[model samples]
Target: MRREIGKRILINSPENENAIEVHNLHKSFRLPTERSWGLKQAIFNRLRGIKGYKDQKVLKGLNFTVKQGEFLGIVGRNGSGKSTLLKILAGIYYPEKDSTIIVNGNLVPFIELGVGFNPELTGRENVYLNGALLGFSNKEMDEMYDDIWKFAELEKFQDQKLKNYSSGMLVRLAFSIAIRAKGDILVLDEVLAVGDAAFQQKCNNYFASLKEKKQTIILVTHSMENVRRFCDRAIMIEDGKIAAEGDPSEVAEKYMSLFK
Candidate 1:
């Protein structure tokens, strides 16, 4: 079965008021059916009139809009399509036919934070590598190099190989670099917490600053506290559909009621 892909366009017009707009969005994945592993099994299943795969709908007919500088939070239970929706907005996945997504300006997806990091490289070397991936020139990276290490609190380990750093240290470094990204919209997926308690507090404060500055952000998080604290508006997805939307507190309460 062939799946049709929808359109996603990016336009950088200052006159455009919305940072993101989605309409009738849908996404589905074909999962192999039981006992349909290899070519032989697939041919046998086809001969037996078995489709050999099941369609799993992750998002269905979602409609929403995010105004410029609005902080929108998406919340849902496991497998409820929150990540799928974010991936679509981030251009990592295409939506079904008839679905439409419009991004008004450059979008930086935090989901791609550690994409270009090389474990064999030193922390400083990896920083430059990752910065290049984020569109920073060598001189630009040098200008902010010290600040990046200071924020990640990994200055002492600058010359240390990334392979030698702890898991938490890697996350901190990636996160520090990611925040320096310049874009009109930021899409984040559960990346608010990194490192120890003190570091988390620092991250929290940084988010607060972004919020104070009215930066456009699309956050997908399981933390209700974060939703209430940072989100100007929120949406909760349930079973591949929008279950609730509007005020952050109200949506958070609706999301919490799911367990009850």
Candidate 2:
């Protein structure tokens, strides 16, 4: 009887549940021209023309699913909604119309580098600020502070104001802190291009470690090499919609073909 029940369960098994599910997602932006402060200019411009302002459709009915432990790369040209999609997934932007984004895990987004950092604040202060934004308590940040500073190699300049630091330094500090914040899902834009070669190598090593741990990663980049090396699967977005989705190499090839 047990064997028969097991067989029946196997037969009725459902498809694997995905870690991230996006169904019919849509987003748009309205570019409205404000009325001029001067009444004469506003009246003149309105009388002359301006029939209808156009709304830009940034994302249109996008649908895809990402499974646990999958490294998914998004490849697209500029203005193709790559950043927008990442933002939506990161909960930074709401879709314009009817849409659903179901994410079933902790998420860490390395989208805006040094965004929460205040120029007047010291590096140490900024570190705490960014940590809090990432949902790390002060005690947790204190526990990881030494490691973060070591990885960022900014111990010497920790007391220095952020405005005094170079762009490379800022990127290093921000990237290090963001990566150390634990999350089941990691989202990265093209921020890897900001650092020098040595730092880039370190980032690659870090990503390799994450891959070994089977962390789910969604990376948006134009570098085909990164897509081929880091991603198990790739998706190409064209004109706010999915154009192709499959093996990283194959999708990359198809994406490149569009330019030719």
Candidate 3:
């Protein structure tokens, strides 16, 4: 089934080629037993001989195309599958059932803080580790090491164990490493929310520079202000589907309306 979906994606390619194309994407996860009403219900289901539980569909038939050098922002409330969509695009998770994801160029995803870090390792060791995870060689990390540290502002704590570092510090280091990797597609998921206000401003400026350099970025953020400032176009996902897609300002306004 996955092979057939891949074939369909290949056949639907645009003539000009896009940075990323998704067709009929769907993702779901099995609900845990604890999520059910109680142990009695779990026992009842077990006694009923139900082995496979119903899964919660996180994404449903989502389709979108991102052009080269486009800055796209994905906005949604909690559990609206915004992060799932970005993860699918980043090749972190394969969609369930019939779905297609075609992406061109290298992808750098900063989806979660401390995602690739080792708590037992020193910050310096983790720097090289994370760099390698991002497809950077030792020589490349050696060349970019100082710059990464400077950007992360963790020079003094470089030798400290990552477990000893604060969450903000971890995020700063991860963000610095990700941005320095210089991938063609950057998937940022609420990364700017981790650090201090001043650092957030710096990160914003860095994104601005990336935009000027024509890097394709897909940002999943709940911050409407950031969406309005950084993205040329924005999309809102509701119930695992595209609710709106258009100008950043207009889409953001409409997204906020749902809360009201």
Would you estimate the TM-scores of all the predictions? 0.93, 0.86, 0.86
lDDT of 3 by residue, 24-99 (tens): 8888876665556777877787788774356788998888998888999999999999988887777667676668
Global Cα lDDT for candidate 2: 0.84
Candidate with top TM-score is 1
RMSD of each: 1.8, 9.6, 3.9
lDDT for position 163 in model 3:
94
lDDT of 2 at 7: 9
Per-residue CA lDDT of model 2 for 72-109, tens digit only, reads 99999999999999988888877654587777677788
Which pairs clash (backbone N, Cα, C closer than 3 Å) in model 1?
A: none
> Which residue pairs in candidate 2 have backbone atoms (N, alpha carbon, C) closer than 3 angstroms, thus clashing?
none
Model 1 scores what on Cα lDDT? Answer: 0.91
lDDT of 3: 0.83
